[model samples]
Target: MHDASAIPDAPTASSPRAGHAKAVAACGLTTALTWPIHDILDPVNTVMLFLLTVVLVATRWGRGPAVLASFLSVGLFDFFYVPPRWSFAVSDIQYLLTFAVMLTVALIIGHLTIGLRQRADEANASAKRSQALYTLASHLAGAMSIENVRQHSASFAATQLHAELSLWVCAPDNTLVPATPDDAALPHQAGPDVARVMHMVHHEHKGVASHQLADSGQLVIALPLTGSTRSRGVLLLSPLRAHDPTLDRHRPLLDAVTSLVATAIERLHFVEVAHQHQIEANGERLRNSILSALSHDIRTPLTALYGLADTLTLIQPPLPDRAQEMSSAIRDQAMRLNRMVSNLLDMARLQRGKDAGQLPLRLEWQPIEEVIGASIQMLGMALQDHAVQVHLRSDLPLVHIDAVLMERVFGNLIENAAKYSPAGSAIHINAEVQGDTLEVRINNDGAGFPPDRLQEVFNLFERGMPESTVPGVGLGLAICRAIIEAHCGRIEACNPAEGGAQVRFTLPLGTPPTIEPESEGEDRT
Candidate 1:
């Protein structure tokens, strides 16, 4: 059960008639008590007792009541206590002075007492409002869903203001829909033509508007639900009791509640958005992992098939020309499939990266030219139609890198260049040490990457020439970027002003071990 007395009475507008009645009743009661003992007390003592009654009335009520009480006390004192009983006319001039002093003191005391009560009431009201807002904020902060916010806010309003309320949320299409309450703790205040009220609130952006709820035949108010960015919805509240004084007195608290509810609703909205994005991200990761595994598993069988096709061509008994041609075709197809599988595997590995806790690279110091040569040799027949040109500075420095991974990076770039360029075009490879970095450029005479899509080419499964007849899953450049980045290098694709696609990559030029000149016949370590 609630401690009803602890709940302070809300401040309200004073009624003149009610104040006057209270003042008369207080004066009458004081007169009746002192009449029997009029002779027992002197004039000064009698005045003091009446003044006390006036002060009590002022403290309990307000300025109007106190002022009325003050005048009534003076009139009653003059009529009964002054000489010549029951007469308005005073006989002695000295007694007139007494009446004058008594009235002045009572009025002054009443005014001061009323001012103090007003200040106290104002302070108490402020404290109550602050406590209510703090409690509402605490409840809102922990609320995770729209439903939780609605329930908490509704309960708080009903308890604090005795107001039955309903919440309406804005739909994505800017329409309002009722938030159905699940619990029966409080009654809903749905008004007829709720849409009209909501429209007015949204368009006006005003504080609050009053409307009659059809269900309860009570006055209901609509407050706009607004967040930091924009208005979200509307809140409807109806005082449970007819002509409820608490509603008008506590309008500020309701405004505060509206603000809190709007903020909570927006917060919940964004949380849901983030949750959806997380799900999509997880799904994408799972898909990539599955595809990577399938590609990796297919690579071994494709390699064996390619070897078998090549072996058929070199059979001990010379095969027919047709059989040889078929074997060549089989070997070419198998090789192409094997290359695709390798790209997929590299793409998967790079995508998963440290997220799967893979082993770190076996980094070693090696000559950059060696990695390039190994990459070209591995491509074998792929670059058969292209002329490969290697341009290395005479004093190029060795780079610290993972040799195998570096080979894969070079292989992917070379393969990409060969696949895009004309069959007989030259594929240029340039390498040199510039300052503390070793920069390498691979250029081919082909349609360069589109300007708009230059950056996107490095994204997994994104292709430079998406519409081209080139057979690939668009993982080559992406894998190249991953491998280069793993070595603390940077790779970029751009079209040279002179024409053709040119890819430039740079690796840090770390200090290499020097070979000490061996004494004659010394063993090598």
Candidate 2:
């Protein structure tokens, strides 16, 4: 059989008054059992029975029931089981020891049992709190937005603690305000003191409670949403009461919730920044495509018009001197426009990796003087006002490159020098074979690029000077860079030791292909 004394009592639905009556009846029954077992009830047995009642009352019912059980045990022992049966009087002097021992044991047991049960209840509550925090953190970790996290957190606090809840977060602009409730369409606003506490928690990484708010009737718990070495925001919970005793007891759980929110907010922030960068990159690409189309479609007809005007100027028995001069001027201006359009098209092709002609380098042995003379002939018109000088090493080995593209590369560089330098300035072109590589430099005495603008000068459509004053659209240097780089070469610009800008490019050296020897006995030789 199950021992009645060992079983914990079920929770009672009785009022405090009715519970007192039930406890008295239980004490009376135990006294009666003592009377039957011993003709004269043993003081020790009465004491033991009284302790049992106190233990049951404390564990299941709490302090009120334990006090009632204590007093009832003393009364029952005196009336039913004491020396003078059925009376409040005792016949034996030793029976006074029985009464004293029974009452004292009842009081002591009531105190000790109540203290132990209170401690056990506290432990159970702490464990439940830890579990709640774990659940909240797990949910928050998967949340994507601050609003979602706040709503879930507030709902958890409200349901678990049985209180109305509100969460206040700090905005990027550093304003502390309460989050609106879902049920109501109205906005939630925090008072001055509440806002102050929220800000303090955010900046200091400290917790603040509702009582800290001066006029707020609700208990506000401010928990900091903090990260490693930084405080991100604050979580403000407004519970129904001035202070929920249970919430105070579970402060650690609330802190865990705040930490989870902080981590989620930081992750979302970086994700948003990355998304914005992608959007901007796409916009830049689209803009570049539009510019390329405008340059090509608009300039094709202009090139044909310029070629016709030049042909008409050379008509037999040319119309008049003035008319011929006007045609020549129109052709020159049209040619300039043609060059700008070609630059745009070339840049577009280079960017899209569609120019396969630039690959499969053709190597050959060619004299440096011959290459320089060809490039000068192509750019003779542009360099008419400037004096051109070519300095080549007598022992310079033949450099390897695509002859057609390399001529264009040299022509563009010399043209750029002439355009930037003064009318009478001397533009020097120098070439030499420098151990396994060929170095070519074009220098001019003119105002050099600003220190900060040196690198920017090579970007597509990036002009060294304003377009209204300077002639070209800044595509010359960019084309120069592209052509040189395609030849497995490098180019750079810097100020010379004296003054002016000097641009240099280097190409790797390659040996000429060997030719077959003729047979000595061949009569044709």
Candidate 3:
């Protein structure tokens, strides 16, 4: 919450009774000044002089004073300047009509003059309001941060509305809190009942005159700072007086102020978002460079280590059985490490290609069954303990894909299935045609994926169980997703009703090359 409590009040108008007293004094002065010239000028001229006085009073003192001046002008004219002077009676009956005409004319002139003056005052107020908003916009345009927005907007509110403000900006978590806790205004006044205020702001998207919400009985108006896309925060404005009439009177200005504040806040939000993304992009680029370089450097050593370990197992006398077993284990571990490094290198290449708006895929028309079978054969000893099943139609169509990458996807899925499920658990692969797409599913019998995090499992380095004893980095599924999406396919993870983790992906089906029959006539020719 950002609070501006040190603002000074603007100048105000004089009291009503004092203003009316001045209007009466002006009328008395008018009668005294016009008395000396009554005989010198015609009575008609005298009546015109009184009407002029009424107009002046109406222009200066507003409606109430104008009304008082109108009645006083008539009484003073009949008693002092007209026939049967110093009395309410008029000797010539023609003068009675004069009295009626003079009084009626005076009241009408006063009313119209006062009304015209009011409209003038309203127009001036509107001009002043426009100028103030323009000044505020100028100040906010230069604001670079939320704090700058707060200080400039609060200063504007203080000078124009004669009120202080508290700004509560929305946090990234979608929670509304004070812009700065240390700067909260009237801790006893606004902070405690914030929950109620924020609820009205977030849901209703308007200001609420929450009169009874304050602890010290002060009124707090909660104005929602709503931007184009969402609510930015709440701006709490406190009027100068409790139950102040001007609170409602100045509501339009208050709302205008809220809109300006919301706009500034929104601009700052997007700027921060862009800055964060830039930082992350820089970090990601640097990380990929390091990983790619390291993968290339490490791959050669790992291949040499695997070959050396394999050669040791086939030594002349074949070493001892214990030595032979150790060599085999060393060979397997080196192979696994080499594959991991290769995956890292592949991920770097894919990321670079993605940055260039495409993937480096070597596409060809290949049988889906052949790719799946090749993947299974590549993971031979890894799948020895697990039962693997493949269910594909005899007439399954050829698919356009990057055979190497697709094989990697299948290999990763099958290896993950074998690693995650209990030893001897069955891994199932099935495929079917749906519309113009072929859907393939790989499932395993195991403690299924965490239900809540099904989609997050495919994010780079994200795993179903982060702390599990699985001995592989979580790149397999992520790489699979990247490769599949490059082929214009979609992938999803779920738990089947039979209780196991399942990953399904879809590839579009299109016309394949027609196979020509090599008939006997062609063979003889």
Candidate 2, residue 142: how far the Cα is off, in Å = 4.1
* CA error at residue 365 for candidate 3, angstroms: 2.4
- In model 3, the number of clashes is 3
TM-scores vs. true structure, each candidate: 0.72, 0.56, 0.81
Q: Relative to the true structure, how large is the alpha-carbon lDDT of every model?
A: 0.82, 0.72, 0.84
Show model 3 residue runs off by greater than 4 Å: 1-14, 24-46, 71-93, 134-176, 182-201, 204-238, 250-268, 303-332, 513-521
Q: By descending lDDT, how would the candidates be arranged?
A: 3, 1, 2
Candidate 2 structure quality by residue, lDDT tens digits, 1-525: 112211122345766667677777777777667777766656666678777977787677667778888877777777876657788887888877766766677777878887998788767656665666677777777777767777767666665554444555555686655444552221133346765666677778778775546354545576787776466666766554444465665576666667777787777677788999889767756756886889879797997889899997989988698999989999998988887787777667665542345554465667667878898997758888999988887877766676866776787789888888889999998988777789998999878776678878887777666643658878788877887788778898888879998889998878856558988887892
Worst 10 residues of 2 by lDDT: 1-10
lDDT of 2 at 464: 69
RMSD (Å) per prediction? 7.6, 9.8, 4.6
Q: Clashing pairs in model 1?
A: none
Candidate 1 C-alpha lDDT tens digits along 1-525:
122312454455556667778888999999999999999888788899999988998888667778888888888888898878897778899877877887788889989998898788778867765776687799898997778888878777766777777788787888777666443222355555755766778656675545454466656778899887777888877776666767667777787889899999988888888999999779869978898889878987998999999999999897899999999999999988887887787677776874565525888889888989999999898899998999987778778898998898899999999999999999999998778899999999998999999989998789998899999888888888888887788999999999999999999998998968879898888
Give me the runs in candidate 1 sitting further than 4 Å from their true place.
Answer: 1-14, 42-45, 88-101, 142-277, 356-359, 432-436, 510-525
Off by over 4 Å in 2: 1-22, 25-51, 91-116, 142-144, 157-213, 216-224, 227-231, 237-239, 243-249, 284-525
Q: Score residue 155 of candidate 3 by CA lDDT.
A: 75
Q: How close is candidate 1 to the true structure, as a TM-score?
A: 0.72
